[model samples]
Target: MSYKQILYNTPPTDAINPSLTTTDGTFRLSTIPKPSNVPADKLLVRVHYLSLDPAMRQWLTAKRSYIAPVELGAIMRGQSIAQIITVGSELSSKFKSGDWVVAYSGWTEYALLSAKEVEPFSVPAGGRPTDAMSVLGMTGLTAYFGMTEVGKTKVGDTVVVSGAAGATGSVAGQIARIQGAKRVIGLAGSKDKCEFLVKELGFDAAVNYKDADWKKQLKEATPEYIDVFFDNTGGEILDACLARANRDARFVICGAISQYNTSKPKGPASFMTVISQRVTMKGFIVFDYAKQYASAVQELGSWLAQGKLKRKEHIVPGGIEGAPQALVDLYKGVNTGKMMVEVAPVSEALPSKSKL
Candidate 1:
């Protein structure tokens, strides 16, 4: 059976600040041709969901980053949930037909990948793999490693997370709390978001950066000073956190969503604070800790299974057609949690023995 897929066009001139028109884009949903002969080592998956991340915005731009920019006319790069439709070898016995899996399938309905390219999920019988893509996947791993490893959070430490209501930030704050933080302070863009951080997500304190007295509020909220700063939105908020850091504080710079669209990236103007406070600021890419991913996933999965952690995802359904705008929404802070677009229904067919 054939499937529909959306293909991206030429890259935008102003990829940093992409608009629908300037991006020179098109949404081509056409039938994907089947391979003449399926490779003996490849697996075919029917994608069910596409994750929309802030990082995607940065990837669209031809900038120097840990990862290379998405080439023009290529499928937009993304992480997604898929079901194994066909397997190519017995060596791929780790998965089977009807098995739900997660893969870097991009924004397409049907994805052809190598067995090494996909991670099989042992969903609870009838559960979906989207759960694997969200709570048990990259977003979870990002929060786990970025918080526990990079931040080096300790019990009784005052942890502050910028963009605290976002996908990574929200999970990071919870992880800090689970690590026995004295106080978990969340900084979000709006009052409602702050409310969600405090009430729904169990953050000890929530401050809205939009407040006129945001600096004062941040200061008041963390009277003991921030010991571990998990920064998702850089710019003024980062500066504020820097100004309020305790001695030898750990600042985990995960992403700078605030600067992604700006022609010029803005950071803390003062290094004197870093010197005076003796702050140890470091940036990390999630892929850097790939070796520890299985351990992290296991721990996070246990937490999730035991109800010690909660996962949130703002799901937009419409397959590949919804991916681009969902990315735009991610930058706009319109999504409340882990942002993802459901592309298609999970496949029910099992892989053939020869294919496997």
Candidate 2:
């Protein structure tokens, strides 16, 4: 069978942001033979949805990162949902044909994935199959671990989050509230997003960084002093948060979206505050906590199932053709929640046989 795949070629140039362009180049639809090594226990998935995250930009660049860079002329890496069209020889124990599974299948329409490479999720959860990739997947896990572990937030403590309206930040703020935080403050670039953070997401306060008096407003909004700061956009915002941190506060550096595109990365200017406040700022890669992923996923799933948590996802439709642009949109702040692309429809087939 023939399938479409998106491949990246050369790296970006000085004029172009590789994240936005299919630098290298994009292979629209390419035909390739099906893998002959399919185990009976492995299922073939026709990818339906793919996630576009800011991390993808880092992956596109040939730089050291938590994950390896996408090889030249290979399919652009991404997380996707696919339906089982064929079963592998080893599949009889856990999964069967026609099951829907999430995998790191990249921007391809079809993928030959083993059961170990994918996880089964019910389609249309909260009315979309992509939610699994958003709130129920890595995004959710990031928020959960960043808040519970890195931030170590406690009741009656003030928490500030940069990139407040974005996927992980939005979820982190809400999780802070659920965990008994006294105040949850969000900072974003636009007025609309600030309003949404305060009105819809239940943030105690939302500040628009675009305002001329943003620094003053942040100080006023967080008068009690921030006990924990979850920084997603590391730049001036990070510096500002450091200045306002209370003694012994924790700063979780989840990402530096602001610095990703810059030619020369800048460091926080207010290092002196760390000495005065005795702050603890630590950077974490989510995979470092992989040993606890199952427990985190289970607890997060339970919260979603019981309506204790809400998820937001910005889904771009089309197939692998849409993957490149979706990744570019992430840096431009075009996505409000977890950014993802819907490659195709999810599978609705039921398993005909079960293995013990």
Per-residue lDDT of candidate 2, residues 207-241 (tens digit): 98889999999999898999999999999999999
The residue-by-residue lDDT of candidate 1 on 1-356, one tens digit each, is 56666555654443332233444563334576766555678888878788888787777677788899887667778888777877777546666766777788888888789877788767642234566776677877888898999999999999999988888998899899989999999999888898898888899889988899999999999999999999999988899999899999999999888887666777697567899989999999888899998899888877777767777778887666667677767888887778888777544434433222
Q: How many backbone clashes does candidate 2 have?
A: 13
Model 2: lDDT equals 0.79
> What overall lDDT goes with each candidate model?
0.80, 0.79
Query: Model 2: runs farther than 4 Å from truth?
Result: 13-42, 123-128, 347-356
Q: What is the lDDT of residue 39 in candidate 2?
A: 60
In candidate 1, clashing pairs total 5
Worst 10 residues of 1 by lDDT: 347-356
Give the top-scoring candidate (TM-score).
Answer: 1
